[model samples]
Target: MEQSDFYELNDGAKLPAIGLGTVNIQGAKGVNSVLTAIDAGYRLIDTSTNYMNEGMVGEAIRRSTVPREELIISSKLPGAAHDYDKAITMIQESLYRLGIDYFDKYLIHWPLPMQGKYVEAWQALIDAQKFGLIKTIGVSNFLEEHLEKIIDKTGVTPATNQIERHPYFNNNEVVETNKKLGILTEAWSPFGREINDVIEHETIAKIAKKYDKTPTQVIIRWNLQNDVMPIVKSSSLKHQKANLNVFNFELTQEDIQTIDLLDKGEPGRVEGQHPNEYEEFG
Candidate 1:
């Protein structure tokens, strides 16, 4: 549980390898969950303006004894508000809502093709960082072309790229590209919502038995070994604490190879239409 056990981002910011993701967290439940996670040694709290729980997220941060310096809070800019100045204004609002003075990492939430302003929006994030309101700026759900566009336009690369990743829908190309660019690949949904249910899958179960851990531990161990930071969401106190217990054990190379076989090639349940073709965000 030492803060030293963190991944150093390409931009020089450090984040706990495992974090508490506040995606579905809401109202009082969200506040309580964040408080509990903080008490259980979680230093990273990931939220988004779109989650509509920043107020509760802010409340939990205020109530916790964890100092702002020790905590690494990250949130994203909504794609719909991608105009440069508007995005800056909205991120300032996000900071206000979270009751924090600055964010550890502020990402362009998604490259919503419908909005058609990601390059301009990315420029705004860079400008925000230069103004010292954000420590690091990055993007989520950006494919190679999108990433290339921003890099080409601004000569600045995202420090990280949050993506839909798990054993099932592992995007190898994205991972490789990000690695070469020094952009960290953060797994938004590390456990495919089915990893726990697949205890009967034999491979995971056997690995679990060998390590004297649960299937969840095996999956997390795999993520760690692969150098991918996994973000997991759980409101349950027991599960929240258990999720971070992954570092105590190690999975063998063979075990990792077997888990790799689970890749389904196709996107998992959360797959979106190609970023260029999809415009659903309003």
Candidate 2:
């Protein structure tokens, strides 16, 4: 299996198709997980300051032999860090934590419209990228209108948009719009938040049996087929290895359509703050 399948960003940077998400992983556990993943040939590591595990992630990176250029490290500015100065400082701090000179990608974690500073924060991101603080800049949990607002104001399209996406909430409209705008769609909770019921749905299980794969494998494969970067989280070494085992099998076009019918067109998890009620944090 290819350890590093590539996905093209709007800016033309190619990201590894799969990443190990470090949300909620912390302390020694986090450090070990990241080291283990890197040692296993995983090139992408996703973490956030809010995850509060960048220090451990940094430690793991230092302990590994992979050079900085070979790793794609992605972090985000938390909602409270939306102010320009604070956002810039937070990013620098994150780099310090990760023991890296610059991030492979940095994102506005969410658009808090009530705070009314994300546009400025977005500008900060652009400037940071220009300064080479990060190689790519993007956002997370931003819907279409929020994305359009930033593009209109700054004329800088986000390189990608990471969102809660899975079979149950495909968000194809958003994906299509992102394609039109040259932004890549990234799936944060690619397994439907461990809602294993989706895995057991008759259609999925039937297809899985046919393919000799698990329901989880089917979902990840579906994401790859749809051209979305799928971030799968796992603390267990066994499941971590299992998650990456998605490359050998292929989901047919018919299987893809069956999964497509699972879209409920509703928000699944981590939908961003409403524009009117956005809050500030630092």
TM-score of each: 0.93, 0.92
Worst 10 residues of 2 by lDDT: 267-276
The superposed Cα distance between candidate 2 and the true structure at residue 182, in angstroms, equals: 0.8
- 33-73 per-residue lDDT for model 1 (tens digits): 99999998888888998888888988998899988888888
27-130 per-residue lDDT for model 2 (tens digits): 99788888778776678888999888989888888888998789999999998888889989999989988888999998898787766778989999999999
Clashing pairs in 1: none
Q: Against the unseen true structure, what C-alpha lDDT does each candidate score?
A: 0.83, 0.83
Q: Which candidate is the best by TM-score?
A: 1
- Candidate 2: TM-score? 0.92
Model 1 segments more than 4 A misplaced: 1-3, 194-200, 267-274, 277-282
lDDT at residue 206 of model 2 (Cα atoms):
90
In the order shown, the candidates' Cα RMSDs to the true structure are 2.0, 2.2
